[model samples]
Each structure stands twice: as structure tokens, then as C-alpha cells.
Target: MELIEKHEEILERRAELLEQMESRREQLKIQRTKQVEKSEAARHRNITLLQDLQKIEDRLRGRQLPRPHLLALETRYWASVEQSVPAWEHFLLGKGPHPTDGPGQPPRRTKQTPSTAKGSGLPPRPKPRTAR
Candidate 1:
């Protein structure tokens, strides 16, 4: 009788241990499922953020002009300005109209005073003395 009771107790303890192991396995599975769901949600957010960043980069690129084209335009504009500046200086100095001006335009002329005009080399005559 004692042997039979001891055997039954041992069997019962084995069954309880198996049940506890199964419960622990189910809890681990549930925790793993939740972790996987969280990871998937984070992945989705990361993908969206990367897409947004790409779109912003594209827009910035679209708004910017190419460097070579901009540089060409700047060079042309400065060349035009440089060409006009010398011509304007010549005109202001009263040298003449710009060479680029057409033939129909009259030459600019400034009036000359006697001091500025070319003169023959001659001595000035003395004024006659007044009668006493």
C-alpha cells in the first residue's frame, strides 16, 4: 500500500510540472508576438520617414538652378557691364561718342574758350600811357 501511494504522488507531481512548463511556453509565445508587432510598426514608421526625406531632397534639388548655367549667366551679364563701362567713361570724358554708336549720331562737341584754344606765339603790346 505505501509503495502504491508513493507512485501515485510521483505521477501527480510530474503532471503539475508539465502543466507549468506549458503555461510558461504560452506566455513566452504571447510576449514574442507583441514584440514582433511593435517591430513591424517601427519599421513602417521608418519607411515613411525615409520617403518623406527623399521627397524633400527632390524638391530642394528642383528649386536650385544648376551651377554651370548660373555661372554662365553671371559671366555674360558682367561682360556686358564691363563693355558698357568703358564706353560710358569715354563719353563722360568728352572724347567722343562710343564707337558702337551708329554713324547717324552726331559727335559731341564742347565749346572752347580763348585760354583753352590753340594760339600763335606773340608778345602782348603795351597799353599807351595816359596824357598827363
Candidate 2:
């Protein structure tokens, strides 16, 4: 009879140990799930930060570089000026017609000095009166 009671007690102890082990396993599973969720949240935040940084870098690079169309326009303007420099110089030196003058327009005349205008036969201007 004593041997039977001892065997039954051993079985009860085994059952209690199994129950404790199962509870510990369930707690470990909950902790593992929480860790996985936290890791995933951190990964998402890191990806978002990287994307934002890329956008900022792209904007900065865009500001640094000139647009192709504007660069082309500027190059063409300078080339046109270079090509017309000789004509502009001739016109400024009075050796060529004005660049913008139309056909049949009279040539620009030089301003005449008072001594030169005397021979033009115009009446002389009266001198200004002095304050008495």
C-alpha cells in the first residue's frame, strides 16, 4: 500500500512540473511577439528617415545644378553677342550704318560747334541778361 501511494505522488509531481513548463513557454512566446513588433516599428522608422534624407539631398543637388535649357539660352546669347561685336564697334566708330536704322533713313549728323554753325547763316542767340 505504501509503494502505491509513493507512485501516485510521483505522478502528481510530474504533472505539476509539466503545467509550470507550459506556462513558462506561453510567457516566452508573448515576450518574443512584443520584441518582434518593436523591431519592426524601428525598421519602418529607419526606412522613412532614409527616404526623407534622400529627398532632401535631391533638392539640394537640384539647386546646385543649372537647368539645361537655361544654360543653352545663356550660351546662345553670348555667342550672338560675340558674332555681332565687330558690327557694333564699326557702328560706334561712325564707319557703319546704325544697326537698327531702316533703309532710306537719313544718316545721323555730328553736333556742330558755335563757330562752325556761324557759317550756317542762322541768327545768333541773344546773351542771358545779368541780374542787376
State which candidate has the highest lDDT: 2
lDDT of 1: 0.84
Clashes of each: 0, 0
TM-score for each predicted model, relative to the true structure: 0.49, 0.48
Per-residue error for 94 in candidate 2, Å, reads 48
RMSD of each: 16.3, 14.1
Query: Which candidate has the highest TM-score of all?
Result: 1
Residues 1-132 of candidate 2 have per-residue lDDT tens digits of 999999999999999999999999999999999999999999999999999999999998878557899999999999999999997798877578877677888876656679867987779979999999
Q: What is the C-alpha lDDT profile of model 1 across 1-132, one tens digit per residue?
A: 999999999999999999999999999999999999999999999999999999999999889666998999999999999888977887767676755677887765556555545453444557799999
- The C-alpha lDDT values of all candidates are 0.84, 0.89
Superposed model 1: Cα runs more than 4 Å off: 66-132
Off by over 4 Å in 2: 65-132
